[model samples]
Target: MASAAEQLAANMNFGSFQKASELHKRIWFTILAMVVYRLGTYIPIPGINSAAFAQAFGGQSQGILGMFNMFSGGAVERMAIFALNVMPYISASIIVQLMGTVYPPWEKLRKEGGEAGRKTLNQYTRYLTVLLALFQSGSIAMGLQASPGLVDNPGLFFVISTIVALTGGTMFLMWLGEQITSRGVGNGVSLIIFAGIVAGLPRGVWQMFEMTRTGALSAFAMFAIMGIAVAVIFAIVFVERSQRRLLVQYPKRQVGNRMFGGDTSFLPLKINTAGVIPPIFASSLLLLPATVMGFLANANLPAWAQWVPGMVGQLQHGQPAFMVAYGLLIVFFCFFYTSIVFNPDDTAENLRKYGGFLPGIRPGKRTAEYLDYVLTRLTVIGAAYITLVCLLPEALIGFYKAPFYLGGTSILIVVTVTMDTVAQIQSHLLAHQYEGLIKKSKLRGGGRGR
Candidate 1:
């Protein structure tokens, strides 16, 4: 027999959706938030010489700046106020999460302090975001000043204004994402990034067609690219939906004159517990060095430091070294993030407290060990899968010069966010149906009493 929620989902249709007023409100709010983000990408910052910056950016568009521009929804390309986007916030989050594991006080707070502790850590992440934004934006400002004609006025005031504008833009985006999370559907930050990538997708497709028409790209190659993309999408859906279920059984117990407890449940562990995070983190870290080097390229450097730019160049897009580094970082973050999000020890203790045990497994320390063992194996498979998905785009970009919008990371973000949003909508519809059923049952009971 299907579960009640599943049955409700099966019965759901357009009529059910029309009756979900709250769901409509959330969807509208999310759309409004995304629209605001898109508009911000077109609002350029002060002191940028538009023509000069465009010419300069065109030359570096195939490099790290291009990737950043894609993530920012062309905000960087436009020299917009939101050029920094929410990258600083993401970097800050990674740092804070890393700290929570190593720092004893933070570890205690994460494990024992509960909601208050989480709030404190979020505050810390915000503070760190500010610091990082200041640094990154300041570096960008100075880099622009070093490039002649890039800035309208090359002076201290221009630097201060640019820093303030970019940093303020990043902070505003962070807050906007939070609002979307609470008041709208889907993850605020991921949706923001998804909106950016999707906004550029039509242009990317048009450019590809233009290439094919101009004979720059062969028709066969174009078809192959499309086929690969479709295959990758199917692969992502399958892997993301896969999970391992562990059977958990509860002992029979007597209460008063009746038997109270004797039931079975499952502990479902996803194959990819840290979904879409490892690839995002790995990309961010790899882009950092290139960002720094790109900025410093405008500066007068000694002969010894000239090699830095050459080395950074080797790490771009499809280079072997870049691929190796990207794969390693993805694997590392896969395990690292998994450990942070799911604690086997805590899970085991909770199960033991509730008198539940896995079949043929010890209840306490041994259960924790078993869970950790299973998760580690699952993570290894997950890491390999993520690495393969992410690397395919790098290969295309490197060899075929495919558009960044078609990259695997962008596709993963788009697909994952869409799936999550749809799931939430389904859940809301199910709840609404359940409420209706309850009300109808109460009405029948009241009628009988009358």
Candidate 2:
């Protein structure tokens, strides 16, 4: 069955896609949603000077905010409503997922709860998103007021307006993501980030060229950077697709007059099971506080409060503290998120229930233990790969003035999302083709039932 499926997939062509009406609609809807998102990024927040805002963001563009600006498709640089991006939702998701590991109620909901339970959890995520948005946006407002010529008028009204606008923008993005997942292609939230990262590619290239033109980067160094980027891209694609497969053997069974014989299958575990989530979560955890501080550096803070922002500023991108925290968090989340998504205990239980067992392993607890052992090793390697990819560029950036968007996280997101989206499209096309064949078979049957 697996071989035949692979053969069928290999046979896919443009003709099949052209015949896929449902897929066409989905693709168009996704494009339209992404376009809307891009347009909104250009829409400046009210009572803000676009030029000054851009200038201020540029001044600090080498910090975490610049990394975030790349993720928001320059929205943060513009101080647009979407400057907050969909991060609040992503942060909320991380919180809820982490809670599931410790909180009994959440554990129950995630493990045994049906679709209804998932919906309930989703509702909780949205609530948390709003709360996070409120705090972050308010801090951002304060920061904006502190920057000279950035805000037209700075006061109570500006703070109130900024908070409302930023929060509303985040909520809208969360809703838009859901709509895209349901009505368009899947992985809506990831795709939003993907679009943002991709949108900055041309600009990053231009910035690289400028560095060479200004003699800060030699022509040899520029070509070397391009070469390194291509190599990194290849590495990312290869590792992301690699998986560890465990073979499961199903025992023969007798059902009535027929012998429901044994079968074998493989359970594939992806190397980077957490996808781009670890970096997003880690970046959010570190950047949220730093962002508040960055904004408040010029704010009317007392002397004690004044030094806090200054201290935190040292933890910005490429700093030792930032690097250590980022790497550790990525490793932690790699294991944590992988465990959340793939539970060995549950997998063992399901296998037992289905009369399946892994070769050379017991059917229950032992099987679970074995799976855990294998996964832990895989997770370590995956985490190391991710960390190296993300942090290796930081050192280079400090010296050569490279763009943060060129880091490993962006490459992972772009590659994984593109692969997943394409797979979904192909699945839809395959389903449509099967339906057509079935209809033709039914018509040729001359009213005789199978």
Candidate 3:
């Protein structure tokens, strides 16, 4: 019967997108909202000389700016209003997540407060995003004035106009993300980022082919590199879905005037609990200085600025030092972000309060310690997995010169989000089937009684 249902779903067409009509409405709303986001990316900010700004960006050597441009879907290069994308929100989220681990006030709020506290935290994040957007926008505006012919005048008008425009863009993108989550199909913010990367694929491929035609790259190497990337993506999908399940048992207890019986359940721990955060943070920290260096590399004023690029270029792509630092950062952030996201102490306390235990482990501090210990080991493996998935293929596809979109972080986000979205769809489908079954059973019983 399940197989038949699966077959039916498989044969579903666009019409079946509305088989569950309410969910279909939500999906269409999300698509429409995403279209608005894509449209805004093309709307350039006012006052900047677009052609000059384009030349300035094009002339600069590749650095962190390239990655930033990738995330923004070329908006930064175009000096578009939405050039900042959703990065400010992402940064704010990271800050709030870190504070939740270290700050007592935040910790208490996380533990004791429910939906209200979450809403408060979210509000704070939004406020932080606005502040960050303003500062970053101002900096970019000043930086633009430094470029030759990029601005008509270095005055308050241009600075204020750019700042206001960029800030408004970031805020609008945030609202779109909220709409996607509430009304659309997948995660709004992640889909936004994914769309940017995907939209750049054709351009990246053309550039690589251009290199090949110019004799800078070999066709054989390009083929091999693409094959390797495909293999790596598949591997990431497999490993991310794998899990370790620990058997958990609950002891029955008498409470007040009620007799409650315990049941058994399993605690599922993923191999990679930190998800895409570790690599993202690691890249942000490691590449930020490189971005600064790239800006200063061609500047005339300072000796350090002129010499820095050559010094850092020693650790260029495929270099050992760069790989080592990237791997180590991935490992460190795996532990750090995991510690921020999951609190074993809280989990242990909740389990004890509910009369649950992990097999032979005691129900209090010991259990907490045990969980931490196990988690540490898993994290070590997880970090190593992430590093390998990101770096090894990076080494393999060194010749393809493809944008690093198929690496660990991208794969992690794609896999985790896909799993979550599929689970939601399955839940809806199951609910629909169950309701039909219940109705049929009721009708049968009624007919027999009549």
Highest-scoring model, lDDT: 1
TM-score of each: 0.96, 0.95, 0.84
- Pairs clashing within candidate 2: 143-295
lDDT by residue (154-270, candidate 2, tens digit) is: 899999999998999999999999999999996899899999999998888898898889997889877876776677788888988899999999999889988885989999988
Over 4 Å off, model 1: 298-304, 442-450
Q: Write the per-residue lDDT of candidate 1 for residues 180-298, one digit (tens) a residue.
A: 99999888988888899999999888887888899888898788878877887998999999999999999999988999888998999999999988887887777756776776665
Worst 10 residues of 1 by lDDT: 292-301
Q: Which window of 10 residues has the lowest lDDT sum in candidate 2?
A: 392-401
lDDT for model 3, please: 0.73
Error of 1 at 445 (Å): 4.4
Compose the digit string of candidate 3's lDDT tens values, residues 1-450. Answer: 346567555554555445677676776787788678778889998888888777766654244566667667777787788888888887787788778778998877766778888888899899999998897787677667655577887789998999999999999998888888877776778777767666676776677677778987788876766676677678777777878777788888789989787878777777888877776666655554554454444444355446665745634556677678888988888998888677899889988887789988988999999989988888888888888887876655443445555444555555666676666666565555556668999999999999
Which ranking of candidates, highest lDDT first? 1, 2, 3
For model 3 the TM-score comes to 0.84
RMSD of each: 1.6, 1.9, 4.2
Which order, best to worst by TM-score? 1, 2, 3
| TM-score, cand. 2 vs. native | 0.95
Collision pairs in model 3: none
